[model samples]
Target chain A: MARRMLNQDLIEALTDNCAPIRPLPHPAWRALVWFAVSLCYVAIVVAAMGVRPDFVAKISDPQFATELAAAFLTSVVAAAGAFSAGCPARPAWERFAAGFFLLIWMGAFAVGCWRDVDAYGVSGLLSHSDIYCLPTILAISIPAAALILSMVKRGAPIAPFVTIGLAALASTALAEAALRLSFRQDPAVSVCIWQFGSVVLLTGIASLFGRALLHWTRRDALIASFQAHRR
Target chain B: MSELSDTSNDRESRWRALMASAQDGDHAAYRELLSDLFPVLRRFVLRKWPNAHDTEDVVQEILVSIHTVRQTYDRRRPFTPWLMTIAARRVADAARSRYARGANETTVDILPETFDGDGAKSEQETRDDREALRRAMAILPAGQRQAIELIKIQGLSLDEASQVTGKSIGSLKVGIHRAIKAMRQALERNG
Candidate 1:
């Protein structure tokens, strides 16, 4: 007769195959790391493209600074939220707080954009380089998105959709920041379509991948990985 | 629903230590911790899923989840909440699965886990009882058959078999090896 696997036997298999267990880093720490990595990329982009000629003058504007600061802060807080969502035992306040940062950033962006309006022609607002916002932002945020997803992978987040959504927000926010630094221009309502489009696209793509990634980290798949390695 | 008791707090401290060792790759400690956790998880899951027979399956899922996310357990933090969070998530997942399956399925595929003195057999439960082994042993050499019948089927130790058969331990081992080969040949021929 075949004996059923006792809890002890199963635990042995799990432990035998387990990855060396260092505590998963705190989500905030990971979020900080992701933000730092994205910042480095943004810095490189700014260096390559060169900061706007009137950077000192334009950057000094409180409205522009507020928008930049809000977007950047959204990346940090949203990262923390994304990381936390993957782990259980997250604080009750985290759900609202993550979205809260995104909302504040969005509000700030709106205010800054509104202040920039001077009844300028659409042509003047977009300029040639400004039209590249969609592609440029998408390109810059790709690595940031990958980095954020890696942070989420440090834990097997049960809420993959929400977790990845936050990660996408953090990533696209950094891309927006890079764009603003490299090619500052007067904000236009039409320009935002491309800006927000990056956020939506990244979030959508990541969420699709997030489901599979999180699902793979489930208990059965984990044991399978260890078991396969043994062979 | 009720608050975790002092005893639970005490247990958490002990589990935390075991987990710390397990995280460091001490399989023995990991096994002990899982063994201990099983009963507690069973009690809690059964309490929540009072009449559901798949309580044991959910408990198993929780154990697996804990194993998967063991690295998430912070040494300085209380272990209970971390463990409870996993258990809660798995239990909810089980509930959702059952609810989804309830819509059209007439039968549950994997049965509700039952406690039996001998334990429930797995889906691939074997039919090779001692009688089957004895019949198989009949196809072996005389010495090999004796080794298979007495030492293997009857579960006698090699030393005990040496004493009973007046054979050395070395010879007994050879006989058992020969017996296994002969049985394999017989099975292959039958096939």
Candidate 2:
């Protein structure tokens, strides 16, 4: 009968429009992991500085300064590894990871300077008297710079990378000032090596990590905004 | 107490009755309402489709959608236009699918122009005429079929069909005129 056929057709159509079954993933897990790892690293670095004032004193020697540069460069490499695992589709994950790396690197510089302030005196550390050792700082930073440049080329947002880089640079400048004030020493060749070398190393590490993980560059962000509007 | 107080309120009583039955999952009431409302939806789809086949398909799709989204529907609002909107969108989707499958293969064939003016034909003759129209419509090119559906069966105004089909009104008019002329010629030849 026509009535039966119509009823059958209506039943068939109704079943197709039921709500979809699959659940969407929660957005918080990626951010939480980045925060935990970065905070743990900050804790370890602070603890190490607290227990080892002798290690800070040894870093003033030229050989020790080179080793410190290599260690900082290694941290930059570690940051790149951290970034590789951190970047996800969500914006919250990217912003959290960026903030985490900024905090860890800045904390490391703070701890390092706080440990060495007694050997270098305030005026000796703060003044442009330490400008001669700029090359040593640039040398330490080379690896980090290379890393950041590679990341920038790949697609990270340049602004965040630049911001983290500037902050690290400022942290190094502050550390040098603290070292000179605490040590009561003039801005010597070793101070130049310590200050500039640390700045370059931190900047390079932050930039490289930024480049590898942050792919939602300005262009991608703009395109995503446009797509959201279209939707 | 409120129920006793509101017993004199006709609107509140009707709302309570409708909500209570609907929430109780009374599918029979839902189906009754749907069946009562089906003719308007069928007429809407018929405008989008020249033949009975697609008209039936679109009607089924709309009914399913209404049932699926029933939970979201506000009991206070009149449901007919909302139902029609879904029907119209489904019809448009069907039209787009037909269009994407390509435009040139199908062509509409009109029914014979020889029905008696006295309306004295037997029921069998009327059924036969409906069958012939269905068969003729099936043979049409997609564009011509859509044109005939929108202009003839659907009886949409030229401007309305133009907006639905995303074609200029002038082009739709020309297409419909050509399709009708072709169908008439085809029917005459078949006779």
Most accurate candidate by lDDT: 1
Residue-level lDDT of model 2, residues B29-132, one tens digit each, is 44445655577677878876766455665675566545433443334444444445556655665677667775766665964554563266878888877777
> What does the lDDT read for residue A118 in candidate 1?
45
- Whole-model lDDT values for every prediction: 0.72, 0.47
How close to the true structure is residue A62 of candidate 1, measured as C-alpha lDDT?
A: 78
Looking at model 1 chain A, report the run of 10 residues with the lowest lDDT sum. A216-225
Instruction: Give candidate 1 regions above 4 Å deviation.
Output: A1-4, A113-132, A216-223, B1-4, B51-53, B101-191
What is the per-residue lDDT of model 1 for residues A108-179, given as tens digits with 9 covering 90 to 100?
A: 656655555545433434523345666777788888888777667767557777887788888888888787
**lDDT of candidate model 1 versus the reference:** 0.72
The segments of candidate 2 whose C-alpha lies over 4 angstroms from its true place after superposition are: A1-231, B1-20, B48-53, B104-191
Q: Where is the poorest 10-residue window by lDDT in model 1 chain B?
A: B122-131
lDDT of 1 by residue, B4-47 (tens): 67777778889989989888888778878888888999998987
TM-score of chain B of 2: 0.41
